[model samples]
Target: MKAVETAPHEYMANYVYSNSGLGAWFGAARLVDATGSKRGSFRLNGETWRVTLSYQESGLAPPEGGETPDGTRVDFDTLREFRLNAVVDDEIGERKVKALIQPRWYGLESESGKSVARPMWELGDAVNVRVNASNVEFDTVETAIQRAAGAVTLDPMYFDDRNEEYSVVMDAARYVRLDRDVSGPVHAREGPIARMGHLLESDRSGYRKIVQDDTERVGYYHTVTLGPKRVRECFPDHRIPKEFKHYYARNAESLPDDHPLAHPKVEASYQGSRWDETLRPVDHDELADELEEAVLATINEAGLPTQPLDDDGLGGGRTYVEDAYFEAKTVDRSRVLPLNLERVESDQRNVVVRQLANGLSPVEWDSLKTLVADGGDVSPAEIADEHDWHPDSVRRGLRRIEDMVVREQGSVALRSHYVAEQVVEALDAAREGVRNAMGTAANAVQNAERRSLDERTDELIAFCQSNGIHIDEREAQLRVRMGNLTGESWSELVTRLKRFWTAAGRDPERLKESVTHYRDEAGPKIRQARGAWTGGQTLQ
Candidate 1:
């Protein structure tokens, strides 16, 4: 089934329709006779042919022995079928499958000499072409192609000398598949296809938009889609001016008499299916070569400037983070500090340092704090023993910010006095914030002890509601009655509440009522919870 060519070569050679996009659907229904249709009849060269549409479905194969002639496989779970039939007689009611059609792109050749002047013909209108035959014989294909080529041409969409709005899809001798992880510039400013940026980019594929000029209200827009095996360029929402349209269009009457379309041509000549990897070159070196030739020929015939991708498949400039990382791995490591710390603005530098500080484990932070306080180089073993941590834990913590620290022999020290000052300042501020928070919580717990049970219950309920932690009135009352607020510090109480909330799948982080922000909201609630916890009532 996979090997069968679904449609006859004669039908393809004789037909003057596209094998992809809207043309595929139209061609299948009409000349190829692959799709069913409303009962109708059309006359071509004195032969009246009746048309009908029928549909079928199959699993993992073509329906009723049908196959995809383009050599692409159907999806694993399903296959589609659309068959065309010709009604022979009304009285006898006999019908026959006219021919099977599998839409295979045959490039820009025509068995018939004619080309569609107005490509946007309505489906009903398109079926009423002046030429047709009992079968797709050479003379029949030629008549249809010639008559259509000789027919009236379409007016341009815009009444302007500049034909900026022309769209075409052409097959190229080469394919483009971008590798995102290969480092380099993803786009270039100067090229035939200029100012290109990717709408979507990934390791294996990308969709890039090329805007030729920014100032023009209406400018040429082009896109190149890259896949593992195929690269297709599309210029949509456009049309060539009448003077130049003849070259790209199927019609060849205006060309020199010796031109292929002007004389004899095979529709599938020099054509290879984009879907069939074996038929066409899988990878075009870059958008700069044959791929560019196809595009440049289409748009002032078009082109792009591209660089070789790096090992990662990401193109363009290396991110500063990656720069610092690569530098850090070197023996000299001279550029690592400036790349990370000196190049960015003050605020950004602080952000980078703060992120580094935040990434350290609590033990790491403690070790750093101790070192900062000591104001000297410290051994990992010494720091670990002071904090009752394993030596490896201390070393690991220091390594998280190793770029900012100098490790020589067995001792680790901040890389510079300035970096030491910054680390100390950041660490001190974080500790102060925590201390202030704990103080507020401790004060709230003390204050709750003075309030009546009813007053405390009201405060707890209001705090929960305001903070987005939902609790019913009954549950609040039960919590106040059951809980005791003795012995636990503010941090311990907050921990207990967070644990229960986490267990219940509620995020404590979303709570707006922080100890510092909602001074009155948390203290009493903490007290009520503590008392209720002792009384064995769960805080809902």
Candidate 2:
């Protein structure tokens, strides 16, 4: 038997008209022509009955084929069949039904421009009676129910005979259900699939929407077959069984394009994607070991010096790899061999020498030397402008050179006659003086100690008065340093005072040690004078 496709509307129309009332029983009876047997026997309601079916030609051609315009010839035919069968099942009892079968037709045109008819019996519908009877009319509700029941009994056979048509309807229903259950949730989760749906809805071509709809329909069919639970299990909130995680991941990957879950957008959002990234097993220790081995091999090949291990065969607390890594990072390339600055080129040597001699930073000396080399007799302002230095800084550097000249040449009046060589020598002398001053200041601060608050205050007053230093700034500095000093000897304070005078460009070396001695020893004499004024009793 052949199977055919039948639209639901057409199938229903045929079922209602051919299988209504007594027509349903006759609909299953096979019609006989003169060339075949005219009678057949079938069991109905557990009773045997004989029936005859005959086709009466109406002598009419099916509506005259429209005139084949342009000499186009088309042939068409519709064929129908009826069969009766009985079903004996222990559960439902015996039942008999007649089935009405019809072939669905499609038109074909031959290469010769002649129209051909192709009859598809597989693309057809079968309607069956519901009751077990030879001849019965379904007029009342009870009888109609009985007839429907008999028809259902015959469905399995009918479906087997018309499997293609049955499959078509079943597949469509399955798709609709899948779209509602599976695709809906998937589309909600997956951005890309949702976008695709929107695109389909907005598409003007109609063709694209049709294609997308078909794809979705097919996807739904496959999803149904795979079972919706497989897809749902892989969702983030679902607790997939440990053994089933891999299975679910595989299923998710294998979903067809019609399924929104299978869409790239949707797949990217699945928990499986994250699981694939992080849950995969890794041998971290093995990788670390391999890396260590590779590094040790490279170090040995390069003949690099490694940190020595102790007699216990351990490199301190670190592994061989760690020590090697440290050595690799900290090894001094410059100290690998001695570097003689004297043997360097004259230009490079000059850069180094100028930096040290002028006490200028490398950047500052480079800028200054570049300017002087380019323009002889550069002004302090011009040097400051060229080097982005403050005018005061440039002037101070010039004054230091002048001071150096006075100190070295033993002539304060010979500053105007200084030559370039003398200027360089002066800068060097100034640099040495600044270094010595900084060293002395650091020593004084380090050695300074604190005295009792009252003692420090008296000492500050005496020092200010004796030096005639009326500067509030110096007085403030002395007070601050004295308050901070703790247990320092008087000599430390003297050194601090000497530094303070030296910073004022004065020679403090000539100050008598009697100055501090007078302050320290005068404490007793002053107290005695106060006691005498208070009438000899020791004043508090």
Candidate 3:
């Protein structure tokens, strides 16, 4: 059968052409009815001509054996094809053109099972093709198709939402290289899908969902490009909120048991128990209310402010109790004393008695009390003499009593100051007593010396009479010498008197001479006695 070609432009509109510089088509169309329609005339170099085209059988079939030939019509069983013939009359002789026109390309198939034609470009080799005015080298037609179909063009402003007025041109090749699934509807509005697309191109992990206008189907979502396998680790199932457990449980059931989202192992006993004996559920609100009530009760018992204190409240907004703080005062007669008066008196007496007993002997104690009672008029010396104690010991005992009184009474006793004053007065009186005793002792020593001297004088007088030395002046001279030799022995007194008499010319010879010279002037018997005493002769 022959079909005449008429509207070539109309026929070419229904098929997709390649950029291989080879005339071809890749899609199905009814071209037999389009051949006879008047569309336009062909013009070459300003020469006009009516173009007449027709087709005839080419009588070629696809190979049936080991390998198929290139450019073979494999879509049909019989390979019913045609040779296209074109004639154009000009000033030269008539010219004829011939070319084959098969029903379709050998391997191309449309969705409706119609044969299609495509450029016979090198299929398995690498080829450089232009897309968006830029050359892109692809290894195969499949790669080229994927590059064109999977490419997602986006405005740079979509990712940078902060700057609305800014615009940037992005290379589609860069996005295609990321291998993101960009087959969904990319809306220009600033929505999740748009953001997701932007994230995918930027090598980010994200997801998006959309509801069609007529369908209410939910729970469907798509995960967009995650940069790499490592990038998918960032979006793990554990990060999902626990509140979404119900939905996740449903989803998990659909997954394999080994999947991460699958339900974990549960204790069989726990699952079987309807009402657990060991565990009880508590209402948190009731517990909170009970705790609050207990706290308020405690606060009220403590006498503290229960409500929040205002700025002008008592204690200047500080929590405080009523009459809770106080200062302690020293104990005095003005304060109320305990009713046990006897016990108090006994304790005071015990302290004073213990101090007195520990510090003094019985005699010393009695004497000290007497001295205090006597208004300190009794001397320590008198007390020592009566007690057979040393006077210094008596004074020490009295001083001890004064110290004990001060220590036992502290500042409370009326005797404390008096005792201090008495101690000072006692020291003064004791010193005066010591001086008086020293003077009395000196007088007694002087008197004893005078008696000894008087005795020695009598002895000397008797010795002179016994020796027949009857010098009447001898007694007076001995008395004077004895007075000068006070505290000396009687023998020393006598020796000193002898030396005095010898130096005074009272020797035997000197006395006899003196007696003769004064015979007429002196008594004769006195001169004879003196002579006998000096000459070692007995008195007559």
The candidate that achieves the highest TM-score relative to the unseen native structure: 1
- Superposed on all Cα atoms, model 2 deviates from the true structure by an RMSD in Å of 38.4
| Candidate 1 per-residue C-alpha lDDT over 420-447 given as tens digits, one digit per residue, 9 for 90 to 100 | 5445655655566633322222233333
On residues 320-362, what C-alpha lDDT tens digit does candidate 3 reach at each position? Answer: 1111011111111211111121222222222233232233355
Q: List per-candidate RMSD values in Å.
A: 25.1, 38.4, 58.3
| lDDT agreement of model 1 with the native | 0.32
Number of clashes found in candidate 2: 18
What TM-score goes with each of the models?
0.18, 0.16, 0.14
Superposed model 2: Cα runs more than 4 Å off? 1-100, 104-192, 197-207, 210-540
Question: Cα lDDT of all candidates, in order?
Answer: 0.32, 0.27, 0.27
User: 1-540, model 2: which lDDT tens digit per residue?
Assistant: 110111110001022111122233223333232324243444444544333333332222221262222222324242224333332333432222332332222232343444333354222122322222211211111232333324433222233221222221000000001112223333331222222222122112221111122243322321111111222212222221111000022243477645433432111111222122221112222222222222222222223222234444444432122110012122211112111111111222222222233344433443335333543344556667777788667666545434221222211211111122223443344446644322222222223331111233234334533442222121112111222223553445445565554443333333321122223322421112212123333222
- Rank by lDDT, highest first: 1, 2, 3
2 versus 3: better TM-score goes to: 2
For candidate 1, report its TM-score. Answer: 0.18
Ten contiguous residues with the weakest lDDT in model 3 = 4-13
Question: Which candidate number has the best lDDT?
Answer: 1
